[model samples]
Target: MPAAYQPPVAAMRFLLEHVLDFDAQMAMLPGLEDVTSELAEEVLAQAGRMCTERLAPLNLPGDAAGTRLVDGEVVTAPGFAQAYADYVDSGWPSLAGDPAYGGQGLSRAVQIMLDEMVSAVNVSFGLFPGLTRGAAEALAAHGSEELKSLYLEKLTTGEWCGAMALTEAGAGTDLGLLRTRADPREDGSYSIIGTKIFISSGDQDFGNNIVHLVLARLPDAPAGVKGISLFLVPKFLPSGNGTPGERNAMSVGALEHKMGIHAQPTCVMNYDGATGWLVGEPGRGLNAMFTMMNAERLFVGIQGLGLADAATQAASSYARERLQGRAADGHGPVPIIAHADVRKMLLAGRAFIEPARALAAWTAIRMDVADRHPDPQARAAAHADVALLTPVIKAAFTDLGFETTVLAQQVFGGHGYIREAGIEQYVRDARITQIYEGTNGVQAMDLVARKVTMEGGEPLRRYLALIEADIEHAADHPLVPQLRDALALLADASSVIAAAEGDPDRLGAAATEYLHLFALVSLGWMWLRILAAAPALGDTRTPRGHAALARYFAAYLLPRAGLHAARIAAGPGPVMELDEELL
Candidate 1:
């Protein structure tokens, strides 16, 4: 085995078996009757094997030799293309897609497990499958019957890959500023003319055809996002038999070298009246895109968790193996893990990793409910909960993920910065989680401005009540009150944000701290749920590490909630008071 990295079976099982309660979910979804914990364990074991065996071994080499571009095609690392082929042959992409479209009909929990595993082993490699899953979700949710029937199966089965074309040079987060245009043609199709940047897998040799879901404004359309419409613009046009035929009018004008995820090609696609068809209604493009965004954003949150998990493992292994200075109490030539400070760092890293992973996985479970719930009321409730949590999930988990990787790098002392070792890759890979899937800043805005502000705080009230209910259940624990206090502080922080809405500067002033406050409370809620599900000290294979890690969060992580709450409540005065010329 290559340096024996221990999977966080404890955290993984705690998430798979509790909090989201997989047993109960499987019981309800009869389609998954054959898919028991045994099967899941088997699958995860297989995932673990594939990740470590195929993916983990590539991290260092892929980083050393990165994905190269030649001519107009992007090349994956040697063996990566074949490994990706094996990934598809395993039907891993279909784990949670609708069975109607060649998926295995599993729930999102399974997808979460697969997500965490792939992310840990190789984040760049994971990007391909991750983006595809999100696009499949978008098509399933809003594509035309013809569109869905034609492309969904191929996408799910990995015959083709999916790409979301939303960002343009003029628009990153502000979709209203997008300059892409779509005009209807006589053949029940549209022609798109615009350029999209930051497109992942935009041009790759991994698949035969890449489906581009482009968002654009129609001719004579109104200004802003109101005129927006979604279009299915494939890289290649499909012939009569559903096989990709002629090259579309689109072309990859250029590819930008990003800070990380270099293995996943980031292209600037030039669409010059590309043959495309409108998806959903004319003026509802953003609405349809949100279907992809919601799921994709949560997955990005899990991406952060996965990177953090990788970081934690890399750090912990280094700790146990790398001999360092003597312990504070003269333990003598101790493993770095023996040092109190090192232990503190390792524990703190685990604290965030465990709960962050749990929250992300739970969010995916709620999404599965939104996908497969038997009752309408339950489905609607699940939808509301997902909407309420998605922003926080993406923002908080990814924020912590970045922090965890930093700590992991720090723990490596000098080895992390050196490219010969792969610890730096975790830091590099973790960086983009906060930048994409709606910047964490945008996520915070969505949480406070939209999700929380719904109907003057009905969503906020419902969320607060739910947190209080969790408090009630976990009251027996001493840590529960501290968490409750954090929730209350979050409420106050939200109130301050609401109070500042009229102040133009307040929005920008509170943006960062607003995200911080949001992360605190959302993580607090998640940690409480995780602690409540602490596993009994039963077996070697069982995951009972929650208690130790929960204690770590209580002492080290939870107190930061107070700081975030204070910063958010401090208002925009201090920030806004600074004269414009002071700099």
Candidate 2:
């Protein structure tokens, strides 16, 4: 039995083979010569098994049982430590970490598929490793060479764990409001003293030593975000023999009991004169932190993808098993899945997840290029693509993830709300994706403000051109005639936003709508492209399923794209004009 989970592998296959052109990615990445379609399927199949058999089984209890906080230590859910150990032993952790640092150094698409699998299986578990990916990315990008050698290897191998400490009670969204201080010591170290709240993996027993990447302001520094600096604040001092010695002055002040992802500790950390080393130069900490934060944002968005996958799978399973009212044309009391409305809901869920998965994977593939392209210009182009797509991947995947998870819950109807049923966990787990790692609203603002206008939409223009090229390449193929049309819809959405002028409010209100529109049309593009590549998905000959998925999105979901077009056209007037006390 497949259990209550959707097979993201099939979707992943569609993406890798058809949508992303996986073989091309393998040709690009060194040591990925073995990543043929057959190998890819086996990898995805194993991922599905591990996630479904190992992780999903623990999620419900993990939520109900949660993590134990005793004496300022967070003990993750049952089987978590062991499962993670097994997962590490399996080499999954190294999928995304740099090759120089004991990682597999495979394409980002591989990592995204792995992430989606784990997230779909158990979100809390997803956090523990997901944080590592962010931490490793930061270290690789900004940390000193010494820092990279010391931390990246251990963190990469899962011998050590990592957490980012950026948020304070006063500075949740606005880093400018933070009051943490870092005074440079006579040596190369600094003395960090501050309070950080909602720090994930701040204090955990999962690894030997937890590395806290803290953000603080230096003495004589200017005010606000510009004044801040980043520090390597370890939980305990690293001794000469790969062991932990003196306890660093960082502790968990409190732990939160949240609505979801309970086993993933949400902590208030106190850094009291902790010995710290600067990762990058002072007054540039925000810039350095964003290196990690951007990666985290994308991972968090994938968290959304994972939960939605779980929800849809769970709902789909329940729908096929649960006897419900017959379809108007069918025999009595067939499975709910036999009904037209249930099919609609399942299709709706797919409408969100399939394309989002493709996009996330595509973004990851680009990451490989950014990180490893032999040429500087090619690397820069990859970096630019990663930057431009990061917000869209984060925001669009998550927003759709929430909707799909809810629909999954609805598929189960009354049972989903009950804890024993376990469907609610997906709902609860997915909610956090929208809240943390830069709120979806923040993501929208970044998309509209920083990503779009700042570049004069050149980045977006480049992405559109790439899509255009993909359509042109696939034009003569039987499965690709519809791709150009999808590209046109996506192009229109991008152009409308790119075309918008001086009216910030006009741009702002429409920002969310535009992102949604872009996501759908983009997914439509992904679907068509992936469909063309379906031959690699064990059999591209069956165009029926892929075509139906495309049609479902095109007919039903694309209208939302149009709706967003309307909202974007309306500008911000209706949204901003409302007075504060209307409620």
Candidate 3:
């Protein structure tokens, strides 16, 4: 069925070794001194094996079986529990975690590579650890010493998984509209009462306990978002010895019957006087939760990248084997891969997937630098770069990822639409990435409004400077000038959106387009870097292949930057003119 899923191990190693110089980068960061290229390669290789053997086979079966609520417990898809046990036993969850909390203390770049493999093979299975890692980060950053001592290790080790509970029926994006309540008690804990919807991995039978980071307002709290506070509410309260004791006052009210990721339990969580401890300072819950949300946003982007690569691989395999029309020479029957249109579709997907992988790797390495760089200036610079690119990665990767799946589906024609082919499943799974972790529209607005316009657009200026520097080095390349032009367009668009500070409508109108422009330029910048690194890739065929993809991206994809820039320059009037009741 559409050729068994294979991890892009060679491609990942190519980027890690030649393009990104990952080993040298890791050597610069603290706690990653021993992480070498050879070690990283071995880790990726082993992870690929595990995923191919243990996880890939589970993807379709998991989707078919889906998740169910047995009594009040959310039971995962078949074989998921054993797979998760094997995952934990293999020490994967601790790969990029903090050493103090039983993690292996590796660089996030390595972890991200592994993440891509897992997500590609089995996205439904990936959510379990993905959400737990996010929760651990939040708790590590803001939770009290006691909370950390009690919960951090379990979450880090995947002994007890974690979930984020921020959404309510009335509040999705607007946290201020939430009605969840948290009341303080005498024993330094609070009673959390709320119902959170769309909570991925909210409940699972695989892990010992689920540590839910719930958001609720206290009795004396102020109104709106400022009143909200984050609480660490476990499914089962930890006893005096840090073991699972009495069951907490919470239940999975229902499971969301969704379009995709059916194996992942998207629960409607109900907290009826659940005992919880405050995670951070009063009235600053959003600040704490954002630490997790920001991490999830980037991870979600990688999810898209993983699925995109999977779909491309599937379509390419099918095209190579499925005989169809004649070649240009009018031979008897040739594989569809010979067809110009099919080749174009496949190349387009490759053009996006390769550089997108590089971009994700680069961002992930920067995340490590931002956190662990010894120099304060280096840390601050890396942090700024990560902040500016997060929204772009989240929005663009998912949007294009979904499109890539559809393109892959197109390659198979009617066969792709059939469930038995397994291509349609990729399309369904890829759709949710664009919607969750804040929709792409929300991401676009964040890119234009807060990230671009804030501080007089300093972040955007610095990021563009990095691109310009890369372009300057690749002057001999044909795509150099075009890349420069796209960067300038992006800069100009940023300035236009920044200049419209007083007009909220202008920001809203330009946001999605502006994000698209930013993404194209960013990817173009990545392609330039890839082009420069091609000669050093050490193989004639590989260099030629990367060069072809780079050319395709410049010729076919980068031009969209202009369209988005034009839309951004159009202002908000055309979009705002239509009245709400006109229809």
Candidate 4:
């Protein structure tokens, strides 16, 4: 059996109500008057129960059985289709979609909480709806009304599924080099011919139809990324009545045998003269698809947070039950939880997971603000905040996610290496988060190159100002001093990177480390916000636990801020000094 996943209901509720102040934020977003703390709690509690009871049981089995390509069609692991049916029947996918598209129109923060619960229990299962929602959002934003009329409702309601087909064999991160072709036909659709690899939820056994958001080049278009265009292609072409009709000319060539997430199909997809309709304008596919990528990036970050927490829970539970060597007091053999080393591992996970969660929730609230805030200036500022922090969340959450799971597995001794205890499964499942949704390395480069350097670091400075404002909000809290110092270090580091205008090498070398530094500082700020909010939450275990975790994070984790800041100031010389041919 997989470990029992206890949804962090209280933690999520505390943050939604107290720290992030979701109630107040919701009130500001028009048409969101229906969202309340009570609704959020209910959604989380129900979603959590479903995840633990329904989804968690399938995790190991999914991993063991994996997905297969049989007779030119992909078949999902056993139990996945039923669980997904239940998931759809629960109306969960509609939580964050637009109200106009047969959805509940809930705030993005609530969806983030739900995502954490789903990911913690079964990440593979979660990808189906996750990609569907991503595709729906992209289509709703950029696709023509006729396309949305035909597809968005089905996608938003979980009647159909979606996939992002961006990478060709020749193009991984460099979309400009992609050779996928889209030749226009007189009927207004295009013939898409390309192969997209490593596609998550590319083809599966569950949903009725799969809608793919594809990137291809128009025959007469300009070269490079500027020539790319986004298209909506379906497994079975929709008839005039918007129902499945004749089969599209796309097929799953093969399934990827991967190191992790075996239940989720990582596919090699081929589109041979597939019919597709263009989205947005020609030569602007990147701009259109970014709508999906940005959303998926943050969602991937939360996946890391979920897996980290799940692993920690499994390891800590095992530690409490498995008797080991005698305690330091020389008594009989005690549960390993009595050992300080075990406690250290547990604390490390807590330190990172709690604040990382807060950061995700904070960012989710900003996503709502960016889209729905009444003031135009506030919306733009919120948009900037989202852009600046997305990569930090993506890279740091995943990198630390891998580390936390390893630490959790280490606490399990040899048992973690095997699958029986279920801890090892988390390790394997989490390994992919670092690699997909754009590798953490690419996220780091984007942080430095686009977010910081391109705009002369105005966004970074603005984010620092917001942190300082929060510091002022929590001025009386214990972590305030540490928060102030981190704020300063982040500000200084931003200046250093901004100053390196002509030095791409320096920017590239320091980018990853700088992102780590930024993430730590961001977490510290979150802890301070939690501390500030704890007192208002009344006498409860949630507040008490929040205080303890904040102290632990400040004492053990915030000190790394100075180290990263120092390295940022040192520039790229240490990294770039060596020649490529050096022994």
Candidate 5:
């Protein structure tokens, strides 16, 4: 049997109820009044049970079996289809979807937690719903009414799955240079002819159909990205009454032989004169796709949280049970958990994970407020927070997640590197998160160039102010002073980035470090929030333990903030000065 995952239920509950206060926020939303804390807890408990029982058993097997493309059709690992069916039948897919379209309309925060658990149990399987939710969000926000009626309910209910078709043979991040063609048809649809690479869940056998949200260029369009358009293409073209009718002119050209996530079919999609309807206004595909990309970015961050949490659970469990060298006290051979290095590794995992979970949930809560908050200015501010933090969440969470998993694998020594312990699977799975949904480098550049410097750094200032308020609340703690100093560094770095607008290389050099600084500060803020809320709890052990972890973060992890700030302050001078051909 694979190492069992002990779901961090206590920590999740603490963050959701105490720190994020999602229940209180939900009470104010129009349709979320019914989503009480007790109900949400119950929902999570059931989902956790489903993951442990249904999904956990499939992880190793799925990894071993992988996905196969036979007879020009993609087939998932054994038991995956049934697990997905169970997931949908349980109303899990509709957890945060539109109620008007047969969804439950729960708060997005609930979905965030659910996703974290599901992903921990099975990262490959999680990608199936992850992509669908993104595609559905884009369609719900930008799709025409007719398109909504035809596809939204089905996608929300998991009757149909979805894919984002963006990358091509010659283009990845630079979509402006893509050569895909979308010719206008007399029937108001377009003939989408393109070959898109790195398409997740591009084709699957479980759902009734696959819905694709494709990015392509239309004829008579301008020279660059502004000319691109978004289209809705499906595996099977719909009949007049909305049933799967004729076969669409699209096929999975090949499956990517990837380093990880073997259970998911990452495809090279060939769209040959496929009939597709235009989504949103003409020449505004990026605008429409951002709705999906932003959502996917957050979901991808949660994937990091999931894999890291799983590794933490497995490695810590092993450390407590696996017999190793003698303890420092000269006791007989004991479990490695008694060793200082093992304890440090486990603590580091906790230090990274708990705060990341809080930030992810907090960001999702902001998304809710951005959409449903009563005050206009409050909504705008919440939306800005979402924008500023989205990239940080995506890049930092995945990067830390990959690091945490490797640390966990090291805790197992040689066994961790092999497939038997399952820790290695996480390392492989976590690698992709950094590369997809925009590379971490691209995300950092976006944070510096678009999010931070956009609008003269008002958003960054507002975010720092929130951190200041939290710092004041925890002023008595020893870590407060350090956080305060780091916050200043963040402010200084933002101003520097904003001022160096004319120098692209300088901006590029500082972008990643600035983002890491921002992530550490954000995580520090979350740690403080958790500490503040811990005192109110009846049980003191959780708080006391978390307090220790918070101290560990401060003494060790937070120091990296200063290192990143130093890099940021140095600008791109040293980096740019290096000769291209130097050894």
Candidate 6:
């Protein structure tokens, strides 16, 4: 078997304390004054213990056993129910929820740390609570007071779980194509009739109830996306006292058989005139749903970050122990770690994993600031930052995450291919991250077409300025100049795409490469920050380790930014030249 997951507690602490200065940042945000570095460390440490002891062992078994549909109910794999119960009893789900809604009200940065741990050990299990948190965020932002009072606490406390019912058989990314319909009732409720496919944790026996935030159109609603409206449809209608009461007119049509995350029940849901309530203003469903979708996009990015770390840990452990070819001294067979090629694969994974973790955490901190900062200007700036980086994180993190897993698998040679080695599971699980939460291709387009040009490109300019300021701080560092050059390339590419506003094909053709270029530069900037903070880390080995990885990233990974920039400059004609039916 592959080496068991070991949470990067020290590394996490180092980022929070030294590199990101998370505690200081939290102090500036309203209501997060008490979120100290020590508290964050303790929380991460305890979460790591829970994941290592309670959740990690369930991963392989859960995947092997998977989920099954029996008599219209989805039954989870063995031990999952009890594990979820334990998870709730320990109050794990309330980490970042609103205090008024029975949540601990911790900073999102801290919650994201816990999320990374959960995802690393048991991604299948993480989906159960992950979707709940996303639902709670949407409802908190747009749900009626009565709806929040009636359901928010239970959802926040994990007494109930939530699922997003958005995709239909014919609609995946295009919400405008959905045929689901909702009709208003005299009692202010609506009758929802639709089929939603690819709903994760759509139904489960573990939670007392499941609150589905569905997207549907009204009877007189306009055509396309403008007609869409958000609704809250519960599996069990709430009673006078708020407990689950009568069953709603909904059932699992079927559970999907997938390549990985087998323990997560991806369901096709049928809402046969299900009783529902409108979440936001009429004809504004997509707006409310995007609130949840945006949160999920960030959460999905962390999922990739978690898997990358897990796969890297497993491969590094194997490389240190597994004897293979002889060392340069021509002695007996030595550990694979001694081989140059094996070291390359391992270092490449590390180069991506460390910076990716930093970037995810950095984004989470900005999210908290965007939501909680007392200053309007600060909040707006943070919001702009979050909007600009969300798609990049979602796309690049998952793309590299899948690549890191495959690289780790390569390190195992033939052994990695087998089930017994366990590395193959990470590869299979990582594959889906790139495809879901809007495919990486779609995310790339969003980054280039919308976010880059949004506010007349002020957000992109602000982001580049931030990087340039930081580069100035470490001007003497060897990697700073490389990061500076990459930033310029990204800026030039952004301007190129922005200049082609009239041509849709230009944006489409340059989207993926531009996003890749952006991610590389962003990660390069992260490595520079790490190098600057290495001295305060207080240990020779730790600082030296970070310096080496920073060097490796500059030498091996950052150069790709140049290639992506070149591709972006190549324009769209070559891509658009081919006819649809041509051979």
Across 1-583, the per-residue lDDT of candidate 6 in tens digits comes to 7798988877787788888989889999888999987798899889999999999999998999999999999999999999999999999999988999999989888898899999999999999999999999999999999999999999999889999999998999988999999999999999999999999999988858999999999999998899999999999999998899999999999999999999999999999999999998999999999999999998998899899889999999999999978988999589999998898899998999888888988998999999999999999989999999999999999999999999999999999999988899999999999988899999998888889989989888988988899898884766788888999899899889889886889999999999999999999888877877866767532424778788888888999989999999999988999997994
What's the lDDT for residue 464 in model 6?
Answer: 93
Model 2 lDDT tens row, 550-576 = 777767776665566667767667888
Model 4: lowest-lDDT 10 consecutive positions: 535-544
What is the per-residue lDDT of model 4 for residues 142-175, given as tens digits with 9 covering 90 to 100?
Answer: 9999999999999999889999999888899999
Candidate 1 per-residue C-alpha lDDT over 1-583 given as tens digits, one digit per residue, 9 for 90 to 100: 1144555655566567766577777777547666656566777777788888888887767766666668766777777788788889888888877788898887677778788888887888887888887788888888899999888998888778888899988798889999899988998999899999998878777657889889999998899888899999898898899998999998877777777776777888989989998888998999999888877888788888888888888888888988978876777787888877888877877887766776676666677676667898777777787888888878887888888888888888888888666778888888999999799888877766677666677666776788788888774665687788888888877787777665656766676676676666666777788766655446465565667777677778888888877776666788878789995
Over 4 Å off in model 6, which ranges? 540-544
Against the hidden reference, what TM-scores do the models get? Answer: 0.95, 0.93, 0.98, 0.97, 0.98, 0.98
Candidate 3 residue-wise lDDT, 521-552, digit = tens = 88887787787775676753243488778888
TM-score of 6: 0.98
Against the true structure, whose lDDT is highest?
6
Question: lDDT tens digits, residues 1-583, model 5?
Answer: 3378876666677787788777888877777777866677788888899899999899988989998889889999999999899888988998999988888988888899999998899999999888998889999999999999999999998888999999998888999988888999998999999899999999988857899999999999997899999999999998888889898999989999999998889998999999999999989999999999999999999999999999998899889889989977888689999999999998999899989999998998898889888889889988999999999999999999999999999998999888977889999999999999999999999998899876677888888999999887774776788899999998888889888887889999998899999999999999899888865567532434777888899988999999999998887889989798993
Residue 462 lDDT (model 4): 78
Candidate 2 clash figure, as a count: 7
Count clashing pairs, candidate 1: 1
Model 3 has a clash total of: 0
